[model samples]
Target: MQILANIIPYFISQVENFSRRERISFAYLSIENVLGFSKSDCILKNDFKINKKDIKSLINIVNQLKKNVPIQYIFEETIFYNLKFKLNKSTLIPRNETEELVKWVLQYKFNSLFDIGTGSGCIPISIAKNSNSIISALDISLDALEIAKINAMYHNVKVDFICDDIFSYIPKRKYDIIISNPPYVLKSEKVFMSKHVLDHEPHSALFVDDSNPIIFYERIIKLSSDYLNDNGMLFFEINEKYSGDIIKILSKYNFVDIELKKDINDRDRMIKAVMK
Candidate 1:
């Protein structure tokens, strides 16, 4: 039998790659995930005994953390929009900035929605959990779509998950809202990203060619014109560096009421345009 307090120090000592702060966060997250002990529980009941089997599981989690594996992938689930979403190496971990995008989308009223590049189906599924909407999502990877399907089923939300390349797939129906958090990170920007993301997450869901960074944006915007109903809305989680370019593309497509929104980090990470 090991006490919670003893196990945390062992995690800090074993996971040498993370910073002190990250190690601490990993410690708390691991303890809670393995033992169902909240941070307060860990502090107040510091003497809480962790049995040998649970301690072994926590050690395995810590070893994976040392390799810069994201805790979400290690746990195979994460909280998005206050809902638990299942994940795997096939899917990118959902970001808080995406939650901001969902919040912005929910501020409007719409009956039908479509999500492009719906990794883990977080975007459309989160919306489905919150609203009475006909939601559909598409992804290029069958593995990713399978994970998305599991997540939608787990949440008991109805989302039509399609496996198809967006650049080639033609829309079969129009939607009241077309939203995407497409891959917008430039290959050049990879140098700035953390090792955990670069090493663990799917590249197709993250990086874009530097010469054509907004390729996904262009295709989605072009398709939106045909797939959106009159006065329908298009929302994107954008790369701030390409915000100006995206705005130009939207304007060229005759989209109106275009707006760029900053995330909590104050980066221009989300944008919206209305079909004209």
Candidate 2:
């Protein structure tokens, strides 16, 4: 029966099973979503009372968090590149590493761009918002494409979304830039990933066969050459473990200026190359 004004400390006490970091994150989200307050408000008004109606909502959210549902899934929306994007089980949630990939791409100039496996269209939509380049993005899941379409429309950016398998997709025209954050997780690596990610996010967008960790990278790199204008770039948010494997594949396929980059975590998570 504790009022909203005292919810943070009470919630923290309730979520003792979660790590301190997780507890803090949940507290912040509770204030923002449950109490309809900003992060700053949580600091300025620690004793802000919660309305009776939202108490049930807060309890539900906390319960879901206890079950390991990602906060993004609970909210059904997230911020990427400072732009808001809609989310669902159909698409992979955007990650900070992917944001680094977008930042890397933004460093270069291009006229036309394409994103394969464009889950929720976060990659292309974010790039389009920052650049004047014409953008086209594709995902095999029609459900995922719809979410992407919603985000594109929400941001008022025109991204041509196509629902088709990339292996069979033949581009109508070449592009100056082609990028993808395709399935790179080894099937065996599932245990290493968080349960929330394994259970909630679309698995097809995440995993590849353990025997072929770079399958999508190989296919996307080969297909990109056909679509890429000469000296144009191909960028990937990569698997850190496959840095050598990825580099070898790109070299065999005649790519140059191949470089591997790390995420904000300083983990090797991205790679870039050019069609030679």
Candidate 3:
């Protein structure tokens, strides 16, 4: 509808923290999702009438946005690595940094792989779709695993999903690769986070104790040698502040060929090591 263009301006006015451009972008995307209209359709049919039901849905979403709800949750789905993933409060939403991790893993060869903390199973599912490797994904949250299972099915890929704490789970067979985008944000950093993330996203999947930020990394590295075949690769999405510290931890565990990589933003966001 011609009036729909006003939706962009209205959201921009209501969202104080986000830039005007960003608010408009969110509104455009939300409208597209609600109306099932392509960019071309929206441009060519500016005068198209919006159904009352669709208008109501759009209004509700915009109201939620005004309250700082994440747009991803507003839609309950998001596109990650060119795949649609169902999202809920139980899991961390897929991010661009995680997409880069998937791309890096796909470039390498592996006989079998395990994804630790596989929220939404995006990393594992994307890798499985591209490679012939047998993949298993682990997450502690059953709700998150449920969404992951649905995503795996939607992508027509079979991934073994397990509900087990990464710290306690022991693998019977050694894997050629282990990948994880684990929770690394420190509790103190909560103050700096947006309300959308702090309030809507699962805190268990997003944070670590500030006193021991590397607890998960320490455990992952300690057990990696047992579960990874010799020369097996360990990949992680790490906190930028502790890239050097994590590399040091891996070195202490005798993980060789350790490498740290930057994300598209040029932040140190990933680390890789080969088990000796």
Cα RMSDs of all predictions? 1.4, 1.6, 1.5
In the range 1-276, model 3's lDDT, one tens digit per residue, is 236556666677777767787787887887788887666676676667777888788778878887878888888888888988888878788999999988988888898999999988999999998999989999999999999999999999999999999888898678999988889999999999888889889999999999999898898888887899988999999999998888898989889999889999999999999998
Model 1 misplaced regions, further than 4 Å: none
lDDT of 2: 0.87
For TM-score, candidate 1 versus 2, the one ahead is 1
Query: Mind sharing the TM-score for model 3?
Result: 0.95
Clash number for candidate 2: 3
Question: lDDT by residue for model 1 over 164-212, one digit each (tens)?
Answer: 9999999889999999999988899889989999999999999999989
**Candidate 2's residue-wise lDDT over 217-250, tens digit each?**
8888888878899998999988888889889888
Per-residue error (Å), model 1, residue 127: 0.4
Residue 265 shift from truth in candidate 2, angstroms: 2.9
| Model 3 C-alpha lDDT versus the unseen true structure | 0.87
Query: Which is superior by lDDT, 1 or 3?
Result: 1
* Per-model lDDT: 0.92, 0.87, 0.87
